[model samples]
Target: MRRVVQYSTGNVGQHSLRAIIGRPDLELVGVHAADPAKVGRDAAELCGLTEPTGIVATDDVDALIALAPDCVVYTALGETRPMEALSEMSALLAAGINVVGTSMVWLVTPRQADDWLRVPLEQACAAGNSSLYVNGIDPGFSGDTAVHAALSLVTRAASITVQEIFDYGNYDDYEYTGTAMGFGNTADAERPLTFRPGVIATIFGGLVRNLAAHLDVELDDIRERYEPWYSDQHIECRMTTIEPGQLAAVKFSVEGVRGGDTVITVEHVNRLTSKAAPDWEFPPDGQSGVHKVVVEGEPRIEMSTSLSHPALDVTEAGCLSTAARAVNAIDWVCRSPAGLVALEDIPPTELIRGVMW
Candidate 1:
């Protein structure tokens, strides 16, 4: 059985943790949490699992690696501190421990950092004779899902768009604040940078850019716009002063030109709360759900599924399943080539059958 270790104890971490523990072919070796609150809780109990292993989650990486886990599942948010996270990833790979992570939205895509980041990771994997893969529901499966959805239609496609809407009633974090996010934009002439390192534009920016490249569409310009609201709004999750109107919305768009010709267009809307103008509820539009994909074509097709699991939103179980696919494919990637890899590079049935098989 493959032994797995996990890092972080947040949304993605929770879902992933449950999945790892429940797997019959995999063993939950350890859990690592940056938060001191959960530093010493049973691995299972910490993640709401009924089966409690004596293993207490810890923040000691050196100790966790000493256990010789086959892989490390990392779901920590590396947006603000990418360099630090990469350092940790480097150490794991160099120690001959495989890694499956979703901290970066575009690591495996061609949009990944080409300088110090990619070079060191490739070298570490080679030195340790191990493999590493980065993926998640948004840029990972959503991009692939949208592309596949578009292929179902015939004729030259004009453009494509993907969007995600979340009910932010329960999201009382600092990340969504208008001042922090720069939500609303007054003019289309100005595409202001929020300076947020991994904003939605920064996160899915590569997806649209890479898609245009793959289609041989010369990219001219990429742009992003934000919309924020505030007022009395009723949210399903909670009652707050900052209601749906007082929320942030992000609109991402990409225009591709072939030989200076307009080839395709991509756009998406991400509303954190309701935009209750004259009449509306909480999160005026977007509600908590799995991402969505829409492709415009001759035989138009669409694929939509809430990526979150039942009874759990971004729990340890989901994180475990996503990370496992990345880990299970490690051996396959090791014996193969180097550089970036995509989910399309791996078979779907094989990925799903990891623990089951």
Candidate 2:
């Protein structure tokens, strides 16, 4: 059994902790809590489990490293603190702990990451002979594996588009939905950090570039487009309140263009409420969220994936999938060669085992 450490207790991290505890092939050795109050608590209590796991959460990185875990499931928020996230992951890797995480979306395709970002992690892995893999629902399975699976059914493909359509009404992360995304900000206010030029590309562009590279297609340039929808009335979401005429939804895409034609695209249709964007795409059958892949070619293929959990809301279930993507890959990541491992590097069927269902 591989010893594991869970590196946060946020939305995704909690799920990661729970999955690690549920799995019979993994041992929960330690947990790193970002919040001071969470420190010293039992891992099970932090993740909503009724029973204790005997393992306690800590804020000390060195203490976690001292455990000598085979891998660490990192789900820390990295969108705003990219550098700090990088440094923390690097420290883990350099200390000989393999890592699988949903943070650092750019690392989903490490080949496309800038040298400054990629080199340090590579060096750390070399120093410790460890490996790091990063993925999640959107930049993780939807854009990579799921889209590739759809492509296999097509004889020829002209353009590929991956979409994440979700209603964030139940999403409870205020810092993300409010400050980072500007979901409740007035339409006239400055664009949120996420809507700024190149931010979308930095986050989701790696998927486009990775797809293009897989097809052996050279991209002329990567382009971005942002469109916002304003609320017609006051709308209160679990995360933030949207006033009349305030931004409530956003539709954005990062496209990979080749010779003036877009080849690969990653798009998101995120709304604070269903009423925010009537014209924009919505999940089929009134579902709150769905990840879709559309390929236009000889035989057009469209595949949509929706997730649900009996005890959790749609948004929470989505977070569980994100956590599972990395947690399930623990064994493969541990056995793989040292360095940044990409989705393509992993055997498609190697990680499937011990499913509860």
Whole-model lDDT per candidate: 0.61, 0.91
Candidate 2: list runs displaced more than 4 Å: none
* Cα TM-score per model: 0.79, 0.98
Worst 10 residues of 2 by lDDT: 348-357
Show model 1 residue runs off by greater than 4 Å: 108-111, 152-155, 171-201, 230-248, 254-268, 272-290, 307-310, 313-340, 355-357
Cα deviation of 267, candidate 2, in Å: 0.4
Highest TM-score: give the candidate number. Answer: 2
Minimum summed lDDT over a 10-residue window in model 1 is located at 276-285
Give the per-residue lDDT digits (tens) of candidate 1, residues 110-179.
3445566778887887777766778765556657645654665657665565654444434433453333
Model 2 over residues 207-263: C-alpha lDDT tens digits? 898899899999999999999888889887797888888888989999999999998
Task: Highest lDDT: give the candidate number.
Answer: 2
